[model samples]
Target: MADDGPDEAGEPEGPDGAAGQPVTPDRLRAFSDGVFAIAATLLILEVKAPAADERVWHALRHEWPALAAYAVTFLVIGIAWIHHHNLFHQVRTVDRGMLLLNLGMLATISFLPLPTATLGGHLRGGDASAAAVFYSVSMAAASAWFTLFWHHLCRRPQLMLPAAREGASRARRNSLLGPVGYAAAALIAPLTPEGSLALSAALVVYFVVGRRAPATRTRVLAE
Candidate 1:
């Protein structure tokens, strides 16, 4: 009898019987896209219009904080969506663990508008410090989850495409900046809410213009 090769004899499978099987990430990405879109859309709804009697320009000037918050939060969410897309583009398959981690990250993202509205409503009031702190903490939490997601992916290299492995490794290293920066912003919020927000904005700009690993071609596998 001829000797059977690895594929011919069937490679060893994981506990879930899916070790060597290729699972497409299309559905996961699509679902995540929907969540991101909904979350982004929800942010604008938090910006309410002025009362019927108020002068339009006066109301607009007075409500500038809400508009600013909306724009900032929208940009933050948009940037996050971009990062999510880039990260998932490197993935070849997902395990149950990855799915759970991704869900955790998405949960944080969905919860952003609450704190944003709070901050916008209080930016110029006596409670500005508290609202700023709350917003910073919320942002830190989201960043932490995103960092964990990258960490998890790094720990499970098999879930990534070969060409993307190097890029993923670099991303895992860069992911730490988010949690650290947001936490710092949280600490600064109590003393200076505007300064804290400035810091947060700086972090966002850094991430936007930061040097990144070269993009790799994704190789899709058969299901």
Candidate 2:
């Protein structure tokens, strides 16, 4: 009934105004959030009660290692979801590169439970250090993937809203802190597991306290 097509007569869409295919990152953000939520929820599976025994309390106490692992990983994933929410809030569009990067990050996020299982099961064994190392290293890899995701956005200034670009460098630096902290923890795991975990907790504190709200955000792409 009506001709619906690109408006050649009007200026381009988006804040950058240099358009290819205008898009909204809403779906990507939503899917990523789902993955994060599922991963966080599944962290608890690492914790299990001891075998059927009359000393129920005593048996449950043996699961403290798993419970500890669950706590750390849960907080880590929870923090990740919050940061991912903030990151996407600045994005208005998605492209092939962005989509691939997002998928890579999500893949690692979804696989987090595997390593969580390993860490929790072995935390009190001879391989405790090894388990901690694996957990920290895996998280470091996830952190790196997330950094690459942000770098993809930084490379394409047009994908983000105007205000986001201005503070992009600062945001990028803040995002790396988690990876750096994880890497450091990985190295320190062999020496002192508690110290390594303490570092991880410190990094979480930094993220929680240092994060700033996005200056502005835009609606999804209508196209």
The number of the candidate with the highest TM-score is 1
| Model 1 per-residue lDDT tens digits across residues 148-219 | 777776777766777776666667777888888988999999999988888888887777666542222223
lDDT of 2: 0.72
TM-score for each predicted model, relative to the true structure? 0.82, 0.80
User: Candidate 2 — which residues are off by over 4 angstroms?
Assistant: 1-23, 50-54, 210-223
Residue clash pairs of candidate 2: none
- Model 2 agreement with the true structure over 1-223: per-residue lDDT tens digits: 1112233211235667555453356677777888898888888776775676548788778887677777777877877776677777777666666667778888888888988788778877888788788888888878786678677777777767776787777667767877888999999989877677667777766665654422222233232
Worst 10 residues of 2 by lDDT: 1-10
